[model samples]
Target chain A: MRKNGVNMIKISAKNVDVFYGKKQALFNINLDIEENQVTALIGPSGCGKSTFLRCLNRMNDVIDICKVQGEIVINDFNINDKGCDVVRLREKIGMVFQKPNPFPKTLYENISYGPTIHGMAQSKQEMDEIVETSLKKAALWEEVKDRLHEPGTGLSGGQQQRLCIARAISVQPEVILMDEPCSALDPIATAQIEELIDELKKEHTIIIVTHSMAQAARVSQRTGFFHLGELIEHGSTDKIFKNPDNIKTQDYITGRFG
Target chain B: MSEAPHTVKSYEEELKNLNSNIIKMGGFCEEALGKAVQAITMRNSDHAESVIKDDEKIDKFETLIEQQVVNLIALRQPMAIDLRETVTALKISSDLERIGDLAKNISKRTLLLNENLPKNLVDALVRVSSDVQKQLKSILDAYLDRSSSVAMNVWESDEKTDDLTNLCMQEVIKYLKENEKNLDDGTHLLFVTKNIERIGDHTTNVAEQVYYLVTGKYLEGDRPKGTEPIVTGEK
Candidate 1:
């Protein structure tokens, strides 16, 4: 992490490793994520990219045998410390996953749920305002404003993904983690979500794990290539795709080898 | 790092095909230039006709290579060296095509020189022709070897070709001034020398492409050059 007299890093991971019982999934890794920029993680399957993403918000804690050893510092405090509150940590770091698993609730309820639980809105009028603002930010307000009471599952796959994004931003998380969020959608829908991501990065730091190299190239400023449990290379997206420093990364991105 | 084969076998084949096509096209340019020189020096109109006819083959090669390059880009979406090589193939093919055309043009100009030229003027023009051919051969070799240093050497050697052209031009102008009947042969010889000089220029363009393909950077600064002789009859 380089300050160089300015605080550009939003998250810094040092010597981060993860293990699932007797099987080690991630090696020692260090990366500094810049503020308000989209950093993409790319690799073949079983390369530990998603594992690294989960480690950011301590999502791996749910796995009974999973253990993470890391000094993942955010804003100069190590979040891996025992004193760190997992709930509060999650509140500050929102996530949208591979599937749009919005709860079986109304559209309005979906957006209002997080803020309500966190006491973000004090009155009915404020909750309505939060719902409208979040939906508008997600670019879904125009399509879903008339159907606020409809089930979130009733929307199209792309619309539901946007609803998930709206829910993520309703609580105003500083960092958003997206794990293959566009894999399940059609090209048109994917482009919609991609456009929304371009809009979202203005207000949040986003880390995305993707298998699509073209998507990674189009959407990210910085890209990291992972291989066989190791971070092989990380640099500007242009260099990674055009002239990477590491052969493994070059091979992977250029489809010479996995 | 050791080179690894692409996972898709056909993609590897396409790239290899593109490479071989470029080399083949370069060979045609060389053959055409050889015949052009033969036509001029031997004063053989038959050789001039053959050189002009063979140029069609070179044009067909350019078309084939362009198609291959386009398919490779659209399908493989090659990156890094692959991308550079693909782009260089397109550019080098164009330059080689022009070389073939210039060679054909030289042969065409040779057909008009019915009057016998001075031995010294013919010798000087042939010298310029051979020098430009040497530059062309070295640049093609640089492309084949993927050697930036060799490409740089070829790039720097263009000055010699230009200097030879200037001397050859001065000789042809002097021969033209010696007799009014020498004007037709002398002017045709002058155009021939200019065509060869233009071929040297195109070869340098290929050298720049080769350097960029190997090193991912264009050569810095202007290319070395020699003074050009002023033409009196053209004005």
Candidate 2:
């Protein structure tokens, strides 16, 4: 495991590959994700960034035909171990999808969903406190505090996305994995989520899969570029965007061809 | 650092155009300095007038090159080596324009010295001018070839022009003291010598930009500066 000062490796993947029956989706991918920092995965469409991200919390196990092969260890626990509890693994490694998928429930119920399942709170008062604190952490408490009984789907696209984030953090996960969390939002909404990601990294290790290079550059400290289902290069954000060593990375970042 | 060509052909063409314009500006400044030095040595008012007129073209070159750089940044949004190349082009264009101005300033005094000349002082000025011209030409080649060592050679030898100018200023002062009747001519020669030294400085400026362009950082250590007085031979 690589260590940098006070930061430690929260997740590390080696020789990770994904496949769907006859077709391979990722090939020999390896990377390290530091604790309480943002690591962004960026590439063109169908480049397997999303496929690789699903390996973090064993999200690919849900698909009958999809097979993930690799060692994805989070805090010394192998996520792909045969007997590893998938529900418990997902709780510690929360995921936010490309679309803002808030459950068709009340706003308070959506934030309270994970804590209820995990028995994080004992009484009604404790559940109310968990909901309030999670919303505050997601920066949506002040906006949606008045109408806690309203449907989560009734909120705006940006607000619904924030509510989903609040739901993810309600479980108090150690790592939050996001897949194009702002693709459906407008520019203003995108900026808001980008800022939230930066803030979220203070408490949770975040891995984001984004199609927007600027978004990756803006939000993450370390950036990994993917091409043709292979992890091409990864480094600090400035070096990757300003002076990447690989030719493909240079072409993609400079807009020569992507 | 061998790499394949860019996939977008038109962006490559725009970058090539920017490079060609920098080389074109370099050629204009070189010719202008050559003309200024020749006009002073041969005492030809016509050559000095042409050098002065050429300054206008150099100024226009800087304007056009600046526009090209801005457009490339806005349209193509270059990164890595291309970004460094465009930024250094902007800096080199500025230095070349300043060199053209110094050459133009020298030619203005060459016109003033169309009267009875100081032959010995002009000879010393010619020696110093030739040194600066050599440095300028070498740096232009270094920039075009993307050779940091060649640019470093020019950057290191900049003090030679300053030392040569210092010696020539002494000769001019002595000639002025010995032949009191040619005081005004000797004074113009002193200004011409200082202007040549300034041109030497601008070439070094362009050399620094070339170093940064190739390596993506400033050259290690401080740049050697001219310590000799502007027009006096004082330490």
- The prediction achieving the highest DockQ against the true structure is 1
Each prediction's Cα lDDT score? Answer: 0.90, 0.88
Model 2 docking tier (incorrect/acceptable/medium/high): acceptable
Superposed by TM-score, candidate 2 places the C-alpha of residue B50 at a distance from the truth, in angstroms, of 2.3
Give lDDT: candidate 2, residue B63. Answer: 99
- Local accuracy of candidate 2 as per-residue lDDT tens digits, A122-230: 9999999999999999999999999999999999999999999999999999999999999999999899999999899988999999988778888999899999999
- iRMS per model, in Å, is 1.9, 2.9
- Quote the true-contact fraction of every model: 0.46, 0.43
Tell me the deviation in Å of residue A38 in model 2: 2.3
What's model 1's overall lDDT? 0.90
Q: Quote model 2's TM-score.
A: 0.89
CA lDDT, candidate 1, residue A108: 92
DockQ of each: 0.51, 0.45
In candidate 1, stretches whose alpha carbon ends up further than 4 angstroms from where it belongs are: A1-7, B228-235
Please tell me what DockQ candidate 2 reaches.
Answer: 0.45
